[model samples]
Target: MSGTGDTAPGADAGELPAYAERVLSVAELIPAGRVMTYGDVAEYLAEEGQPEGLPAEGGGGRRVGGPRQVGRVMALYGGAVPWWRVVRADGRLLPGSELRALAHYRDEGTPLRAASQGSDDHIPKIDMRRARWDGRQDERDAPWDD
Candidate 1:
């Protein structure tokens, strides 16, 4: 693939990694009570978007094209993945027919830094800048672990 989304050299389009699979890897990695942003995962996939230690190079750099793209995958097929980890850009939840998503978040101990401060009209957001996980690089890199 010469361009960003182009088929990698000698690689068939069908051989490319599925975006949902990438989404789920991190989803599964997130501890039961933690969460992440769609853009955060997008950043991880895009390299530039991830923070210091995300495995951005994974998925052969072929994760979903963007955050919105990731969101669409989750919307359609996130039933088994950690759907709650992905929140809106502003830290709000992505909507769906299952009213239980929010309730599930509440039950899993997904951090709610906003404390429902916004409004009655919106799902309470987590303030991405504050609550975003730093990924496990720091934990794995701790001097004691080695």
Candidate 2:
């Protein structure tokens, strides 16, 4: 599959590889309050047809199981992805241009599982271990469970 041609909220359909598309889909599914890590996105993207077993770092030579790739993707072309749903591994909001992601979170009313003021310029990241969502509960499922 080359391109789905369906640009989602945080992704550019035609520009992304099929795997990135899949990751974007999963990210879109994340509820407003919950969040996912880059590693999660990479794994999900792999599941969606991204090549697996390849190293994720250093041009895919290093093992990448965390959220770096996903975060990088979102940082550049996350306009259509549910970017707010994909936070840094530390639970800190992903950096963005013009508070775009933050606006979505505030507008969507996503729960702030972590503390952040945005004034620090260097936001306090969230702890993914504690903030990463499994999408198990009803509320978690609502954002994309349909």
Candidate 3:
């Protein structure tokens, strides 16, 4: 779908792919001081059009995408949003942008764990347990349950 229309949050409708628009919208929903893994964002979007308790693959809606697509969207169009909040599942800071992401994390009070003494980069890792956000304001309103 190509059109010169406005979409959600950070992009013009035709400027980005439909899936990319949805991906960025989810990224924007992430609360400050919290984060979601790439897979989390993808899974969230995939489930958005699916029926309750149904697997994404079984849903009749168009396939949104997966972790790699999310990463690609972020890498290409994430500069204008809180790109740092979408992270690796293992909690390591994004490579190459580690210092930049760390600054934002510190500013937002995102939970972080000290890197082990022998860690390669010496940058602190995000404390995934404490910092991961489920993108739900309340359990009852959640689109899907674990």
Candidate 4:
């Protein structure tokens, strides 16, 4: 595993750990105007690999890594996917890439909440209540059944 070269998108196969690849695959599946938390992405992959009827949060008996691991994968290989579509559980934009991500969110019409009253800037934050994607369904229920 140590010797594997870059496995990010556009790179050759086998460069990424199997789990990392699966993580990225799920990242790619997230649609525009929608977002999944790192934990959500992990759970989504877990559910997809496991049989139906598993617990929604843990994916019964499966071992999907936590949000930190999912974030690591995103840090290393998420450039090719809709990285912005994967966000924190709190719905705050990625720390350093907030503006860039905000652009995408705006372009995609992702739901957002105005900055808090005491905040210095007017930068809007994602409205997780409205924008979170569970990888199960969108508002239209067009994709991802189960």
lDDT of each: 0.55, 0.52, 0.74, 0.72
| Shift of residue 135 alpha carbon in model 3, Å | 1.2
After superposing all C-alphas onto the true structure, candidate 1 shows an RMSD in angstroms of 9.4
Q: Write the per-residue lDDT of candidate 4 for residues 48-85, one digit (tens) a residue.
A: 45434333334343555888888988887777778888
**Candidate 2's residue-wise lDDT over 1-146, tens digit each?**
11111243434335665445545666766666567767766665444233444224334323343466565556556656566677655555654432555566557655544445555674444444444666443553333221
Candidate 1 off by > 4 Å: 1-17, 48-59, 62-64, 96-99, 113-118, 137-146
lDDT of residue 62 for candidate 2:
35
Tens digit per residue, CA lDDT, model 1, 86-114? 66767655544224556766787665654
lDDT of 3 by residue, 1-146 (tens): 11112222444434767677677677777888889999988777765463343333334335668899888888777876788889999999887778888999999999999999998778999988888888775533432224
Candidates ranked by lDDT: 3, 4, 1, 2
Q: TM-scores across all candidates?
A: 0.61, 0.54, 0.76, 0.76
Q: After TM-score superposition, what is the CA distance of residue 67 in candidate 1 from its true location, in Å?
A: 0.6
Give the deviation of candidate 2 from the true structure as CA RMSD. Answer: 8.5
Candidate 1 has a TM-score of: 0.61
- Candidate number with greatest lDDT: 3
Which ten contiguous residues of candidate 4 have the minimum total lDDT?
A: 1-10
For model 2, the stretches where C-alpha displacement exceeds 4 angstroms are 1-15, 45-66, 96-98, 113-131, 136-146
Clashing pairs in 1: 1-8, 1-9, 43-49, 43-50
TM-score of 2: 0.54
